[model samples]
Target: MARHNPSAPPESVISIIAPGMQIVGDCQTEGTLRVEGSVEGSIFAGKAVVVGEAGRVIGDITTQDAVISGRVAGNLVIGSRLELQSTSVVEGEVHARRIQVEEGTLLNGSVHIGETDGSTLTHEGQSDSEEQQLPIDAGSWHRPVVAAPKR
Candidate 1:
């Protein structure tokens, strides 16, 4: 029998949860993990996570990158990128550095994207991220002419 050491990391690793399977506990991995069935617990991945169209997750997810085409009922915290396909249905908050959503995807909660590293762009000595009040010049806009109605 070969000995396995948990202290060292593998160069490349990929884990998969197949269809018709049910997992009821938290899962953590240092590499990519794919889910094709149902999970009732949280998931943590150092690399990426891919959820199939038939998959379902009922717990939170933390990962670097994720591609979801399934149903999620908890929060998602993605460090890099996140993609939601047309078949995906999400009902919880989502936080990701970057995100892509398909036209038919259904998201029922708040979504936060982009970096939040305290580096905000500034314009006119004000933070561009904040709302701006533009001064309206009366002569700058012209109203369209309408035809008069005949009595």
Candidate 2:
């Protein structure tokens, strides 16, 4: 039997929730999580979270960073940054250190940027990561093919 370390860093692990699959409970992970399906519960990611255009999430998301091109009907608590694609639809509050929303995106909630404690950053500097732009091509996410059952 192999031994597993619980406190190990997960920068190399990328978890994918493919299309046609539905998750009804909370998901917690230290690695990157890509959602191309539907999730009805909260998601807690330590690194980053990506929601493809075909995905739909009905619960909150807590992550260090996030990119959304789908529908999210819950609050977003992003520690680092949040990117909203043109096709993204978010219907809840958003709290992040930095945010970027492209044209055609639909957001129906309050946005709180800066810090979690409501204190604004008094510095006059911007990091390279903060100046990064959202990707121009996010509609090409893979969509799983589903075959009809034979009668």
Candidate 3:
């Protein structure tokens, strides 16, 4: 569903994936995309992307801003900001200029924050995943989350 009502402005376009719906292919739009169901492919949005509590995504997402409160099983490259609500579960690389994460959010991969260019997070100068360490620069944080050794 598209928010193209008569009163809605032309530039304020919004696409909605209502509940019980499923999209199997990539979705590209210059406006906003509010997902309330499931998506099996990548989503590219110029403005913003919102995933509701029951929403789920199985592929990468590249957007200006994203608010995820459900499950995302792929990488996220957000240009401006990213917010993960308490119910969020993300399982891939996350790159964003800014991030807000709640207490119960489950993140199971690398996280890169305060990086304007989200493309250079290749663990530069690091060869082993087990030995990956967070940079000393506190303002810009990049760390790969790994399981701790058994006690």
Candidate 4:
């Protein structure tokens, strides 16, 4: 005999942007998102956002958490935490409560940690002195997710 539970919550969905695919507009999701291709617009995720080694996002990203291993050319407004792998490259500002950056990552913009006051982090330095910091933890590393093409 078997019993069924009707009140169980559904599993969290993970949206994938397959390789060779590209998105041109803003993307908003209530679950996790994994990007393996290219996105030209902003991404707003209710959960975590994962960017693979080949992923590229040209616009902003607003999420509760993020694990990035690709290239991001716009601002990042993460509410809770953010993790940047060794292969990640970022050219814009970042705002988060907690951040972890691996070695070998390249960042060409400013970073603000702590309270955001409901506003996205803005570049506070002059153009000639753009701040760049990579606080990589020597003992930790993050491996990017590699997606296999569907046959």
Specify the highest-TM-score model's number.
3
For model 2, name the residue pairs that clash. Answer: none
lDDT of 4 by residue, 1-151 (tens): 1122355322266788978899998887766778999888778877778999999888778787899999887778887899999998877678888999898887766788876755543223112222443443322223332322334
- What lDDT tens digits, residue by residue, belong to model 1 across residues 1-151? 1123566464147778889989998877777778998887778877888999988887777787899999777777777899999888776667788999998887766777887454342212122343432332323223321223333
Q: Name the best candidate (by lDDT).
A: 3
User: How does each model score on TM-score?
Assistant: 0.71, 0.72, 0.75, 0.71
Specify the poorest-scoring 10-residue window by lDDT in model 1. 121-130
Against the reference, the lDDT scores of all candidates come to 0.71, 0.73, 0.74, 0.73
- Candidate 2 has its poorest 10 consecutive residues by lDDT at 120-129
* TM-score, model 4 to reference: 0.71
Q: Model 2: per-residue lDDT, tens digit, 1-151?
A: 1123566567547778899989998887767889999988778877888999999887778787999999887777788899999999887678789999998887766787887664332111122233322222224223331222334
Off by over 4 Å in 1: 1-11, 117-151
The sequence of per-residue lDDT tens digits that candidate 3 reaches over residues 44-140 is 8778889999998877777878999988877787878999999887777777889999988878777878764324322121112223332222221
Clashing pairs in 3: none
